[model samples]
Target: MKSIYFTIALLFFVFLFGCGDETPTKETKDEVVEPVLDYYPDNVGSKWIYLNAEGQILTRTIKEGEEFSGITYKMWQAEPPDAETEIWQAESSDSEAEQVFFRKTIAGIRLYTKEIDKSIMKLIKEDFKPLQGWALFNFTVQSSFTEGLLVELPLKPGLDWLVIHIRAAGTLLGGKNIALTLRFTGHSSRKEIITVPAGTFECIRVTYKYEGKLEIAGEIPSSYTETMYVHWLAPDVGIVQIKDAYGTFQLIEYDLTL
Candidate 1:
């Protein structure tokens, strides 16, 4: 009977305290991380110097943030005021200082707006001088233009998007109709290794093409296309080289420390 009582007491003691002295285990969670795309670096004070097509050195710097229609954008200023002014100055008059604004998101980088002393409307009018058709469009100034998507995120070969579309129509003096359409398109072509004055880099090759269609009664009209600019963008370094009708612009030096 004593042995049985001892066995029962031992069983009760273990049942009461065994689980109480055990340590609790923690529940762990798995974290999901998001990927970041750094196609263009816009840190304030970051500067990039390039040798423009005209054999002239051009410098662009990321300055203070500027606001447009309640939204803020990074201001990019190109020094020496006008590099391609000669191409249109005789027709549009003396050019003025210009600043381009940009905004970035997960989707892509956008041309939020731009600033210029001369009116964009005036420049467009001068392009079609002989016809003298009234210019009607969305943007009076460059800033007035709708947000233009400059680069699409997760870029891959053959990726393309319509950056901007402009249409204008008016009646000419001789009871003839004049119509014009202009489109700016962006394409992510391929990866390339570029060597410039700055150095060599592996970059994403992006091209901007301008397509235009002009129609005037009794005049032959067909759409024409030309490359406005080609950019070799280095990862996190921004544009390393640019090729345009004037010539090629290559990166000479860059300072991204800021």
Candidate 2:
């Protein structure tokens, strides 16, 4: 729980200050073939290592390439593989940041959602089938798309997008329930030179704000937590650096086979 909490607080920061940028990808919306976004690399075998503010390091690797329903996805996970790690999806896009599909497994059950849009990534949609004791605390949910966004695309300095997300869930017995709705309004245009273990390069700084509501058992909580993120993305290399209050995930090594 501590690790999950830490990641949530950390990634939220990556969304607020720096995320997307100005480099035009090699592929655009003009072709019949898959347009590979130049700014984001989806090749298999790609790897990234980041050193946090406290000197602790986090690592991710593109284990393989996968295709789903005619769309290709680059599978990413921690350096040392584990069972609980989830696989994220990014469709082919030459201009905008690909929407990510969230997926993972817990205990011994599988769970995931299906919301397809190149610019949308639906989070917190559903939980895997319930076990004997897990369902009492968890709920099931359906669909809620406030709207998607435009990211990893070519932006001059002040372009933004409003991305929506909705999640619903219920207990195994269908008594208790939980739901959440969030809209992330993001804008970016700052550019900076970043140096990591991989190399030094110009990166687009993306930052954004998140606002939404949360409901559990049809009741709103008295207190709510805010979320934000700042990502330093390097064109041609993908996300080279992620920053937050705790530390940083700076790219130390990578292998994106063109």
Candidate 3:
């Protein structure tokens, strides 16, 4: 009887120690680290096709050959606006070297160039003032590129509004359809929170918009008009998507490191 009792006690001790080792401890909610904006990329690249409300392709290659580096972008769009097919291309190397080119069925349409400066951005921020609305905020900037002077604006308003405004200039065609491209830099905000399909994730979003006219001097004496919106979804390291009035393009597959 004594031996049996001693054996039972030893088994119980072993069982208790083994169970303690196998059971996992509950993690405190506070100890869990929520994902930060650092997971988003700084740049985004994509190809897009613009469709009308009926879901018909209205414009071809709206974002083809479009690449966003940091705060700047280059893109082209072609559409059959009238009986003639119109092609437009815009490029911006920095705050400078922004140019716009256009071609229509009409012969001898000239290309225009313009300059973008700080005063333009300030003027835009002050004008077309945006009112906080919905999950987004909207604002416009009066900017000039080689093509002509125009306005750039963001339609969505939300947290980190200014950061989106500054990053946005880089995404504009730099006055691509018009003439010059507006380059925006120098941001003060760092933290961002956004609602994504996966869930609400913290991130830094950059946005900008511009519109203006294009003139080809001594060419087809007509002014071409354009308006654009750009958004860089930066969760942390790089951009997750590049969004415009047409739609959003996912960039995670092209570069996962972001």
TM-score of 2: 0.53
Clashes of each: 0, 27, 41
Off by over 4 Å in 3: 1-192, 197-200, 213-227, 250-254
Model 1 residue 256 distance off true place after TM-score fit, in angstroms: 1.4
Model 1 agreement with the true structure over 104-178: per-residue lDDT tens digits: 766777765232213334544454444345444332322334576777875556788877555555555556676
Measured against the true structure, the TM-scores of the candidates, in listed sequence, are 0.71, 0.53, 0.25
Decreasing TM-score order of the candidates: 1, 2, 3
Window of ten residues with lowest summed lDDT in model 2: 103-112
The Cα error of candidate 1 at residue 41, in Å, is 0.6
| Model 1 stretches astray by more than 4 angstroms | 1-37, 52-55, 81-96, 113-120, 131-145, 218-220
Instruction: At residue 230, give the lDDT of candidate 2.
Output: 62
Clashes of 3: 41
RMSD of 1: 24.1
Better of 1 and 2 by TM-score: 1
Worst 10 residues of 3 by lDDT: 7-16
Local accuracy by lDDT, each model: 0.61, 0.46, 0.28
- As for lDDT, the candidate ahead, 2 or 3, is 2
